[model samples]
Target: MVTLRSHTREKARRSTWAFLPPEIRRMILEEISRQRRWSCASTVCKEWHAIVATKNLNRLELNGASAEGLSKIILQRHLVRQIYLNIELPAYTCPQCRGFASSSEHGKLAKDALRKLSKALAAWEPTHHITLELNAYSPNDTDHCFKNHLYGFKHENDGDLLEKQEAWDDQRHGWVKGKQVRLPTTGAIQQLFSTVISGVQGERPQKVPAVKGVVIRRQMRRKIDRLALPKLLKQFPNLESINYEPWRVLFHQPDLLDSSCERCDQMLQDGLPKWPKHVRSVTIFEDFNEQIMEAIRSGIDPTISSTSMQIENGRRTRYGLGEAFAVKSRHLEHLSVSFMIDARDFFTSCKTLSDWPRLRSLVLTTPLMTKGPQHRMSDFLVKAGQVAQKMQRLKSLVIWHCSHDEASAVIFLKNKRSRRNVHGSATLTWRGTRDFDFSEEVVETWQQVVCTCNSHRGYVGQCDSHQLLCRIERVEGEIISHGDAIHHLRLPDGVIDPTSLRQIRQEGILQREARAVEAEPVDGSGEDP
Candidate 1:
């Protein structure tokens, strides 16, 4: 116990980090490197720096880097697996009396960098996944509408939105009421993709071949440019799938939608390659229109497995949802349909869909239910049940009442897919209601008295004990208030937000006493209060 020299030596050994196994140390360093935090971690030692230097790099931002920069970074690195760019291409730029020219000098430089990348990749790995976040560029920045809170400019989520036109659509030509429709500028990305094809020339291939998947993010909220995607597919011969994602899920002004163009028609037709066979998993109204009521009847592949159709402030029948899913009925898998109209229009439009042989899941969000002979919950349930039975492989179905209508109830019913196989039975997960605890006795009695009542009779709600009743009182009890006050969460002023939440015990007594002043008459006893 009195051996100081031995104790000091033991303490020194424990302080050394070398005791960690080589594999374990490498793993920790690799993970940190993937997060692009290698520099911070490498300060510990030379060995860590050496190990971390070779880990897969996070996506390199192409727009921020030049060709030479990319080449140097990717020079000896075997782990550069992905890259992303919010590119504003040269061709899409306005050259003369231009509207939007926020110049991206690297339009051609970007292609060159990709070529260098393609060559580097062909030697080592086959390809890297590319995420192209596409947005229309605007050169003119002096327009105050683009900056400040003017013309809904502050409505955009981009922090630098005050300076840039990446979110340019909000600055419409006719900014108010969308009088003048602003067509999407497709030339820039079109030119970029056109130049990035594989092996067009000698040692230097014109197209960048380093690609496995292309994630296309449409920064502008407009009817999808069907022509733009087909051209992209041709640019990368080896691209397994061309996918689409909105940079932001925007709620578009219904009046501002432009599905066709008088000027871009010839341009759209001029450069489309033969449509290749690929799954059309794009959203309905957001991605396609016109002949695309089936959504791009001629341009995109007919086969589809998953799709989302959200018709805000509109109906599906007008949107021509006819033959949209039906054409690819057998191949359908996942579906999401939300609209403002009654559920009947949606189902009626999709009534042609008697079979969804491979359908796996469905989500239907609406304010109104189907109108049938009796038009009760039973009709809705029966229709839904019938739809469910057709989907032999269906896993989950969600029915949500978005509660956007006046006095409308809110409900979120998620069904357990496994229970569908049971004879005439389905399992639904019911979220809590304000009346849930109070309604138990009523539900139990109703179920016991008429035990013969089944799901088919629309007794599903009471049986499951989750029938929403919030609307019963709201019809006349409601009065309009400030939007923020009603929509946002509120806390009493004197209540400390970050304070200890153990138990206030004394909070709300004052409010209760005030409420008691106007409370119901009560007997002098505890009975019949």
Candidate 2:
């Protein structure tokens, strides 16, 4: 009896251990963190809660509730390495009055919240890296009012803000006044250099540590005043990466450049031979202006040579490839241009492509369908093929919203053939859309094309297989009966021998055996043979 009792206790303990080991449990908890409903795991037990609160959590998603909950979470000062916060700015209202706050009040609330968050972040972890994404929807009256209020508040409180505002004020007065303004002189630039050097030499904590990157997106409104940028750039000396879409007005007025060019000319004549090279990457989202293009064409000082340049809204204008990129070829490593150009004009004007030996990435976004009969998409493809053949160092190329008919594909294939023979390695990604029925021949041809293209020494690969598989999978579900679906398909005889598949069959056998064992009579009756 004592032996039987000990055996029963051992069996119960072994059964309890069957669920999962500690390492397995931790992995399951970590996997749950990737999903949006991670909080559901929190309710499972204390063991789960402790696992979920670890510092190195890879995926952090903040929904509406979590945005408000962040204040509490930050207080713990947990080692949160990465955080992604998605906040939907609620309709602003005063908590005290419980009434809809004025637009100004709403703006004040936003600014105060950001300032408080910044302070908390600074205190919690000075070295903590963060990527803040502010996703605001289409602006309404409230948004406009809020922005105005924020502007007013910054103008009043922040002295640094006043500098940019003063620059704008100077631009408004045409830069001619008894204003006694303090412009960014040579002495100030020298002082900035000294400050950076001192910080480096002393090995002291930097006042404003350099950010990894910053992205600012705003809807189209007024034109961005070019006069305002120099001062803003000066403030963030440690800035390495910046992406911004300033308002459109900056592009509409050509006169802004006329004045700027005159100013630069005067400065150059006075022996001020160099421009500041603070920014390494730049993206300008506006129509190309001829005057500004002329300034760049005159020759960019080697000191300020930019590595990346992305120009959008390059529509029908005199500022084509010849006028825009011909001169700055040596400096640009990545270039993206969107516009319509005649095939002949593009080939002839963009002949200096050899200068950009370091260029590795190129993107050309052009119209797919031609409205008039004069210009055809085929002609565009031929020209694009010629350009690709010339760019020997090109690794990644994207042609957005463009048709890739047989002729276009042939042109690309020709480039691929040449690249294989010469460079021994080159990869290109082609994306397109077409309306065609799915057939065995089509599938075979696509597979052949993919295999042949990828067999080359430098052929990285293509995405046709994965895309076609997805389409076929979708169609399979639509055509097949529920019972005959691919998920329920039995393996072929040769694919897996019955003997190997038989192991899982034992589970059914055991279940039947259990039923038979349970059904045995109380008198211990023998099985009915």
Candidate 3:
């Protein structure tokens, strides 16, 4: 009686593929890495498994695999170029609480799993990329941030107003609705990756394990105990890039030095740098405070409007993100920052863009842009122009402003042309998306602007001095009325009133009729008499 495993193995041994050379077998397995359909191929026999294990796999997704199993795989294989640790947890009865559990517990569980994973990674050679996607739980269902107010539970006797208040409370704290939760300490995260680096260093003191990039797909709602960034970067001395989701602001406390303050202090001291100069790219995420949120909703201060490109203290001093980051990584080439409330200050602080000589591409985005006052957009354009003035290497500038104004939106385009005409020619592009409900006249003007630029057909020199390429698109839901390119402008229909167009057309016809009467020759009989 032959079992299935045995039967498969015997058949694989007798197959024509079994006679292929070792190099050909390795090549076939390598192709499997590209296709990502290795399950069927690996089941052929032990020989096929041996071949698949050794080739360099660019990316390995451990969906629900155990750390021990992953460790075994790492031990058998060479370096895995990238690793995605995908873990999913659902709401369930908590054995500890003996009731419904929340997402905080799941977060803690993820930390523990990563601790084990870090230890496993330290035992093997360093990997280039590691992405943590542990927070893939349903955003609508997770109740980690929710809280219950006193008398908040709906009463059978409570009126509609009270019920509505209770619902608002529920919605506010819904992400964390349960009992008090404890977030993972910075030390735990540091030890996880540092353990691997230290362990490998102790065994082979001569070799350096350079992990180039680290990405965090999960949002960090709580502040770590210490500066996890500095500690982690010290381990991977050659780290080049880091992409992580946003965390809440690290508030200033009398006893605690926030990461920003600490970095600034470190920079002032001229001590050993926290991160390597080799770092080239960083994507930073900023938090939202009540003041900034209000400004975003209502408007920004008018006093700072005059000093758009220059540095101005606006309402409050901006966070020292750009200053501190430049202090640590002087050689950075690419930087993208997403701000919740710090958009204004971040722009102000970037006036020192010349300090980072290597910087080439900068991307700035804020949810506030969609609702910001006109002054805020004006200030942003000024700051962007200042940055452009200082940075000779800057070639790309992308702004995601959700506003409706032709003059403010194309400020960069105007600035770029000015610089090109004066300075040596540079390949400069000012690109972004604007959400506007355009009036018929505005749309006509924008179309003319685009057509005027296109008619020149010159790369740069022959084109009208002030004219540059432009695109305007009308978007209805997911469908687009324009071409399918990233630069398409999205305008929904109802944003512009049709009645306004009719009034303007009627006025134009009246003006034309009066002009014709004035231009017409007087009737021969009545004019001279």
Candidate 4:
């Protein structure tokens, strides 16, 4: 009887659900969608199914080996909007190569997969905003970063999280989590991380991502390069954008130039490739430097925000990414090719940021360095500020530090066009340029350590506490006082906040006066009169 009553209640509630206000019903549906329970929520009633029908993209699944079926959808061009590709290419291994991975089964499989996709795309137009999310890897018997993160059991009970559901599938011979596959060990699976592009000398520039239980070889990277993925990607003139996560990437400059192709050779000489004219955005970020992370964890005195972007003949050959983006296209708006170019060649390559009128957002991440800072933050900001001055339509400009756990400089540009904002006065414009945030403890530490130089020479070193300000301000150990060091970070006068400047100046004046009083020798007269 209790079960019957419960069923009766549920049936009555379903009818009453429609009686609720339209806005309330819509809000409920939106909440469900946000939680990614769309499939379950949409089936509740006819009204919901109608609302969600368009949002759901039932992507056509196709294997890379048999992508010929994709060409048949040419008549129904609208159906080409979304696609999920499953690729399983024939492995080509050469034992004589002797542990060299480019000829390994993994590299061959990745190449074959891309070749198949290229053939299929020959029939399709490049105008669509299509993105291919590649889940390319096979089951291998080893404790790798990919496997551990995918299937590791959760030990942290304090945090609220959803348990991952996985099961053993015998047919696929792997651990399956929905469509994601993780097979148990063997040499059957080839390693893509070991692969590198042509002309990329030395080790495959790769670092393990920051995750629990990640096992990376402690020894330095070995020199064995040659993966055709980079060169092949550049050949796709139809490719409008590159979407990749840097932390998980293997190479800093994966778009390596191939010497074999005559067309590529010609483009290299021409200073620009045959990139799509309609390309709007190109963003690429670099993985964190391990040294930077170690420094921060060890509480190093200096803030290692700066890095040397040293190139091994790192000169801007036609292969430099900044040169690739130096096209004179009106359709280009947002451009970001980080870690692809260093500060040395980047500015010279794209010396025409002012020319791109429609560009609204710009993000850059320079190459990583093993040595000390290449240039001061002040000089870096000066170059960035010059770029900002000419950009009329630019709204957001970001420059990431080439290190982990270090603050990056960000500038927020705001334009107020309305006269009403100023009580029917002249049109007003607002701009804000600020550096990274500092913790209260860090600020307190700096504030406590006033420069102890009597003659106004840089002498923060005399203080009992080791001040980190000089390192951050980076005025070459010549820090006169707290304010002088801070003042080194100069933005355009128009963008700098007047209140902040005044506060800093006031503090400087007070520090100088106190420092002067402390240094005065005793009169010994004992006469106040």
User: What are the per-residue Cα lDDT tens digits for candidate 3 across 307-377?
Assistant: 32121112122245445544443466876654322344455666655455776666554434445554554
Ranking by lDDT: 3, 4, 1, 2
**TM-score for each of the candidates:** 0.46, 0.39, 0.47, 0.47
Candidate 3: misplaced stretches above 4 Å?
Answer: 1-40, 43-58, 61-65, 68-71, 74-76, 86-112, 123-210, 219-226, 247-276, 285-317, 325-330, 340-343, 366-368, 371-379, 402-529
Winner on lDDT (2 vs 4)? 4
lDDT of 4: 0.36
How much is 404 displaced in model 1, in angstroms? 5.9
Per-residue lDDT tens digits for candidate 4, residues 145-173, read 12222211223222322232222222243
CA deviation > 4 Å runs, candidate 4: 1-55, 58-104, 111-128, 145-190, 194-239, 244-272, 288-331, 349-354, 366-375, 410-412, 416-529
Candidate 2 TM-score, C-alpha based: 0.39
Clashing pairs in 2: 223-249, 223-250, 425-458
Q: Flag regions of model 1 displaced more than 4 Å.
A: 1-9, 20-56, 64-82, 89-214, 218-224, 234-322, 335-354, 364-384, 399-529
**How do the residues 203-309 of candidate 1 rate in per-residue lDDT, one tens digit apiece?**
43444455555654322322234444455455455554333432111112122212222122333234322423333232211221111111112222335322332
Tens digits of per-residue lDDT, candidate 2, 262-333, equal 232232223211212333333322222222222223233445434322112223322243234333323444
